[model samples]
Target: MRKIPVKYGIEILVICLTPFLFMISESISNGKVTGILFSFGYLILVGFVIFGIRYWIENEELVIQNLLFWKTRIRISEVSKIEKTWNALSSPAPSITGRVEIYYNKKSIVISPKNFEEFKNELLRINPNIIIKE
Candidate 1:
């Protein structure tokens, strides 16, 4: 199993802290209980943010795991295209630093794997017909 490294882990940490900090101010102005509840929820979100995303080849499919609750599975045979993108829109990608856009069955998803070249090569090994737009 290949673990896709997270390059923007620090950025994610700051993003997750924003809410908690906001809640601290809200607590000072509102109530203690509300602050406590928000803190707990924020911690849970932090856990998810820290874990980020992981991708690996499983069986004959590509598995993208987001946090602990969500996952995306794409069959190697169904992949149609792969391209580099600057799009920062949300998908299965964990970071916006560098992203790979994948097209399959008229649908698309963006992912940011640390070792992009290796990841692309792995996919190409499975499906050579995939049009890769460098």
Candidate 2:
């Protein structure tokens, strides 16, 4: 099992909430009902950040847990291919770091591991049939 690095969680939270902070500050300057709404929004944003951080810290098996919705894991023999590709729109924005693709049969999953090269090599060691692409 592998855990997401704490720095990645903090970076993501900061990037997402920085714009809202600016908006909230502007609303306060305007001195209107908008300020109250912005304040509430800020609280909600903070809540999300907290949840994300907790999730990152609690989760293990980086790819398996992070891409569970996609059912990434299967018996090693079932894997047909593994390749790496980049797409700003479909992939996670701002590219958290150490991103890779895990392919099994007809399905594919995206995950960001803490030590990408080591993770890939480990996977290959586990299942030599699995392919790795640059």
Candidate 3:
């Protein structure tokens, strides 16, 4: 199974921290306590974002293993269909990020892979029975 690259996380960190850095710098110039607080809060938020992304990337697999939660394994044969879905209102909206929906036994699970096309192709190779819908 493929995993997200470290650069992806770094890129995300840079993107997110840019505004925070700007705010912190401006606050320093103005000498306001609010700016310092905001900077601290943003730092914590960025750390959490980094950790969450890393965890999701590392743990993303067809067969998920969890100590607290039950292990779930999706067999290739059980997959009936694969599709890419998008919606406007969803938090972490599909417009900004792409998602893969895997249909099996009348249920579906969605995962966001770094390389969506390659992920779909691998899944198709594993299960030729899987229908790829536009």
Model 3 clashing residue pairs (backbone): none
lDDT of each: 0.77, 0.53, 0.59
lDDT per residue for candidate 1 within 1-134, as digits (tens), equals 55556445456567768888888778877878878787878888777755657778887688888778688989978999989898877666666667888899898888877887888888888888888898
Lowest summed-lDDT stretch of 10 residues in model 3?
A: 87-96
Candidate 1: residue pairs that collide = none
Model 1 regions lying over 4 Å from their true place? 25-33, 49-52
Residue 68, model 3, lDDT: 30
Best candidate (score: lDDT): 1
Off by over 4 Å in 2: 2-15, 32-63, 66-77, 90-97
Which of 1 and 3 is the better model by TM-score?
1
TM-score of 1: 0.81
Question: Which candidate leads the pack in TM-score?
Answer: 1
Q: Report the lDDT tens digits of candidate 2 across residue range 1-134.
A: 43444224456567667777777777778876777697777878565434433112212222343222432235545555666555333333224554566677677655555556766665666677777787
Q: For candidate 3, lDDT tens digit of each residue in 40-70? A: 8998876654444321222224653322344
TM-score for predicted model 3 compared with the true structure: 0.51
85 Cα displacement, candidate 1 (Å): 1.2
Tell me which of candidates 1 and 3 scores higher on lDDT: 1
Residue 85 Cα positional deviation in candidate 2, in Å, after optimal superposition: 2.7
